[model samples]
Target: MGRLNTLDDWLNYQENLHFQDINLGLERVKKVYQRLFPKGVSFKVISVAGTNGKGSTVAFIGSIYQQSNFKVAQFSSPHILKYNERFVINSVQATDEQICHAFEKIESFRGETSLTYFEFSTLAALIIFELEKVDIAVLEVGLGGRLDSVNMVDNDVSVITNIDIDHVDYLGNTRELIGLEKAGIMRKNTPCICADTNPPASISQYAHQIKAQLEFVREKYASDIGLIGKHQQQNAATAMLAVQKLNKILPVNTIQIKAGIKYAQLDARFQIKTINNKTVILDVAHNAAAVKVLSAELAKQQCSTIAIFSALKDKNISLMINEISMIINQWLLVPLDVNRAINMKALSNEFNLNHNIHVCNDMQNAINRALNDKQYQRVVIFGSFHVVADALKILIPFMKNNEEEIL
Candidate 1:
């Protein structure tokens, strides 16, 4: 295999790699990984799996560990702004050239074995982490934990953020079934942290079955986060307890944990930014559980709220709409340009919100119309990552222009 010089070439090669199906099977990918990188079992890895808050939890763990001066490697999925954001070292995104180089190595090593796009990327990340001699690596599971490619490695700490009904088709319909799938990341005698306040019985049962030290959020450690939303408190608490347990073995200091938890800035989770003297909040609340949290946060704010929403077809759009209906004065439904995107017409028909809702096919137009409206004091951009990504592109430029004019 030839080396990849440009980002586009690497991405193109990845696109042409084996197809991806969201399921809980790892035999083929694991065999390829074992043949290519047999030494991966020696690395220190932390696997995080949950329906929501996995990214934020990974960020918090990485930030705290990095603050303590440990060489840390972090891998996450479904990047918002850049592909490089998925892999980070010491709190900085890996350069495009670095990522391409890693991919090139993986491509050559695999030989006759075909790897899926995600499996190839995960292997590349592991290779980079090993080469860097990272003291610790945090991996966010792309789907259910048991058979997910990331679970191929033995993790020192397995973190489950919260269970919800996002991927019902793959996992299961109820929370217990989903919890069982996620609990697969836990290894024998390893410390597993459950961030969910009310975790499913299956998760606890599996932890006991494996003899893993299970730590529940409210039961293990309590936290008070400066960030808004009740759900964030649970995330923070889970992170704090995980770090506390990690501190017993690793050299993570309490001061670093406090500092990291206080200053962690995950881009799209209740993110508030002031643009042109107006407040804009961006949250990636595409599921029913997340929308319920966002609704609570909206109730606490003393401003007229206008929600810019979009979601994928697989999601429970009707339930999400029903949750946010009373809280938002106007609904700006924008269509995402993706195969799984839910069209505005389908959403409108399902919810019967014609009076307060306005359909805009273009995301930029929806954001501009919402931002320009003087009636609403606060504008919230929530839904899928696609919607939030489009809004960020527009909002960043608009805010920058306004700042430049003032200067």
Candidate 2:
């Protein structure tokens, strides 16, 4: 293959290079990783694994470390806007030149191994982080913890952020079975934080068998987190408890924790934007668990909601729709271009009884309807992350109206 110059070229190469999209295992990636990085990482590693709150927990942890003057590198999956969003060095996304350089180096060493798009991108990010010699590396597990490429490095601190029933295909259907998979990232004698106060018994048994020190979330930090919604408070508490275990190495005061939780901003979580002078919220809540939290938050909103939504075919659509029906006054169902997206007719079956349900061919048309329509009090974009990513383009002209989220 010729040397790739643009970021698009690198992404296209990665997409085409893999035979399968999600090949879950460590040996193939670990073997190539070793060749790319002969000398292992010396920085403190914090690996976060969970069903819903993994991204928020990582954002909180990374922001706190950054505020405390520690050089931090974060590896998160599923970029919302751009591929560079997956790799953050010192709180900033890496430039195209930087990512291309990392890709070039990894390609030079990866001779025989065939890596998936995610695995290859993960290796490239790690190579950059190793070269930067960051003080702390915060890695968010892509899928199941045990076989995830991110789990190849032994983490100093491991956190499981309240596992639910998401990703049933790969991690098993039951919570107990899934908890065991998430617990695979825990190293022997290292501190393991279970953000879920009521995690399955298998997690406890596994941690005990591995001799990993485990801390269950309790009254340790019950105070409200900086973000809105009760679920966010729980996520903040989870990150707070996990950080306490690392206080000796990376000391941060209560003030910093307060600031860090307040400053921790993600792309789609309770993100508010004013589109054409009308307020709208963007939340990526596809699963039943996350939708439940979103519905609870919606109840607190002062006005009626008009939601522009799209969900993947694999999601539990019935539960999500039923949960939101309690608070949503109107629905603007849209279709996404992704392979997994569900069409409007398919989505109609779930909310068939609702009188106010409407449909549009695409996200932009839905946004257009939401902005022009006057019946609903506020517009909410929810369901899958892809819907919110596409909706951002429509809201770009009104970027100044976006509240709390950065550009």
Each prediction's Cα RMSD?
2.7, 2.1
Model 2 clash tally, residue pairs: 0
lDDT, residue 19, model 1: 60
Model 2 stretches astray by more than 4 angstroms: 220-224, 401-407
Cα lDDT for residue 152, candidate 2: 90
In model 2, the Cα lDDT at residue 262 comes to 79
Clash pairs detected, candidate 1: none
Per-structure clash totals for the candidates: 0, 0
Per-residue accuracy of model 1 over 145-254 as CA lDDT, tens digit each? 89898998888889999999887878889999999999999999988988887789999999889898888777433454545566766777677777677665577777
lDDT per residue for candidate 2 within 117-188, as digits (tens), equals 898778877878888888889899999899999999889999999888987888899999999999999999
User: Local distance difference test, per candidate?
Assistant: 0.81, 0.84
